[model samples]
Target: MNKDIRNLSDRIEAVFPKMVQLRREFHQAPELSFHEEKTPARVAEILQALGLKVRTKVGGRGVVAVLEGGKPGRTVALRADMDALPIQDEKVCDYRSKVPGVMHACGHDGHTAALLGVAEILAGMREDIAGRFVLLFQHAEELVPGGAQEMIADNALDGVDAIYGVHLWTPFPYGVVGLRAGTLMAAADSFRIEVIGKGGHGGLPHKTTDAIVIASHLIVNLQSIISRQVDPLQSGVISVGHINGGQAFNVIAERCTIEGTVRSFDQEVRQFIKQQMERVIEQTCQMYGAQFELKYGWGYPPVVNDSSETTRMAAMARRIVGDDNVWEIPPLMTGEDFSYYLQKVPGCFAMVGAGNEEKGFIYPHHHPHFDFDERVMKTAAELLIRSGLGYLSADSPEVTVGNLYR
Candidate 1:
């Protein structure tokens, strides 16, 4: 680490207590997606205290704070998701969520607190830095289609040069930061299959075509798309999360509905999976003498990192966290709404390790017992601050918008 970054790291360590307090306060009163009314107000107050120009309701409870530096240069963005999931809290901590059926199971509270901490640190060093820093507290990350697209619609990234986002992942060990040059996260799409067949007495199997049997066959065949169709090197997942059919066991159901999600890193593979899925459902239902309807709802796109931006940010992260703490992990099959922002601007979304076995904070995200190690909050904050500063100081390059849909 260089002298400048070492000093910033020390400053971040000094603010550890404040970061913990902020995260605890947010954890106690969690809010759901697109309904973060009080969350934006609280985050705005913190940014206001740091003397940054704040804009609220950019995209329905999203807050953007622009902090101008002492010198003139390009603008950079640092983003943190502000919404929590609708999961019941099971942790037995004093700071456990007070809101029922809503909790920060995905560590969004820690993300918000880390960004606020970065805002505070950057505000103090404004005189020594160049260009502007935009701190984005986004809402509705867990919601399909994401709040990031809404923020772009509101022109949040209009003048931004580069953007950076981070997620606190439990899969990585504590004190380590993970990054990848491309395809950091997968695209998520949902599908529903409805099988229609004749209904009759359960005892008379020959009298009616069993929709339940047809649905079962379709579900099993759907798994072959990943193993047999897609290349082994390409990552894809087809998971049937829910199934609904007849209520009574004695009666043959007229219709059976199956719902699941499809995930993939490559766009071509994602498209191929969807196409093969339709074929599988149609052929399987026909074989069972049943009619089928397939509905595929588009979700977030794959998060592809810009090579130059990711490489530069990784170097800065190594400087802040040291070489031993920096890691280049393989891309995850998980999906992110931040992919929307990367589509509009050249950016990178990396992961910060928040798991610590000693503190019993090793649960995966979205789990009821999931909790983040508050000590890692400062690390995330410093990484955001340093990355923003570095990007702003670096040369401003032009970004080309290719055929994103292809």
Candidate 2:
């Protein structure tokens, strides 16, 4: 089966042009979170054209396509996120987004295109393959309460076996691939803090409680949660991204607001940080004689990959990109809703490098100017193909996620 899977490189090569074309098309017309309509329609159209059993409007806007092989074995699933970001495209290229202020800033267009390429290649090899293949084209990965959970609730994973997925990462150079046995990404959560104080003329410092000054102090003090509260060996980050306060230079503001995100790998650490943050908020407000409110919302859990599946997929990746390029990288602070899928079944989430310095494709993801060397899409597609088939060819142990940190 490995030999047979290797032979699909020519097939992957043959489909590369179409993959680029599809990516560019999706890039030109991008869609955001829940507003996705035509993208999933086109996805269903493409999958239906390939003669697979397709389900649409799944869990809201997700699309699922099932391809059954001639020989029976187990069912394996491959997932790709289909939504774009709210960022406006800044690059001056032919395929730059047509939709104003909506762009595929994070390379989800490339993800969907690569998975479609895999479907095309595998559909042609159906007679020679065993087991079934489930292709999940999910929506709303950028926003929390993501499509993964909704899709799962819609019975997208009502099957017999394992799953696999990939992300085209720009930090690593083209041809390099990365994954870890434990947590690959962090659990993302967000919060909003409001400080209420007495207002007075700025010239009279003693007359006002000064909410703006309190918010500024709160921002600096919150870092202590990660530094002093959380264990030094463990990882945690509290970044305040947004803040609002006074209206005029001469006036002392009565209210101020602060908003930001929290990222961590451990559930207890996540909760502990929140508790410590609340403690800091209460103490700081009391000292300033200010009334305060804290609103915290939990997002996706951390993405933990199965040890056995990740090991097998890493061994498989060495064949395509060589042993040196296969990476067991440190866990990322980024969040992924794919964690929801891994919770229900055993699977592996892999990352393939799309950055290339020579071609000037070095922009990080989610930036307005973000873009990657499109050539790596083929490598990503091949990895998905090989991983999905490899999982089904042999009896794999049930997924067991190891420690949060290596």
Candidate 1 lDDT tens digits, 1-406: 2455558867888787888898999998999998898989999998998889999999777999999989888899999998999899999989999999999999999999888888888887888777888889999999886799999899889799889989998878778889988889989999999999988899997999899999999889999999999999877999999999987889999899999999988789989999999899989988888998888998999899998778776776776678777788888878899998898889888898989998888899999999877877877887787677768766423212221110
Alpha-carbon local distance difference test for all models: 0.86, 0.91
| Tens digit per residue, CA lDDT, model 2, 1-406 | 5566768888999999999999999999999999899899998999999999999999999999999998998999999999999899999899999999999999999999999999999999898678999999999999989999999999999983888899999999999998998799999999999999999999997999999999989999999999998999999999998999889999999999999999999999999999999999999999999999899989999999988778768866877888888988999999999999999998889889999889888899999989999988888888888878877777433223322222
Best by TM-score: 2
Q: How many clashes (backbone N, Cα, C below 3 Å) per candidate?
A: 0, 0
Off by over 4 Å in 1: 1-6, 395-406
Q: Where is model 2 poorest over a 10-residue stretch in terms of lDDT?
A: 397-406
Candidate 2, residue 57: lDDT: 99
Query: How does each model score on TM-score?
Result: 0.92, 0.95
Clashing pairs in 1: none
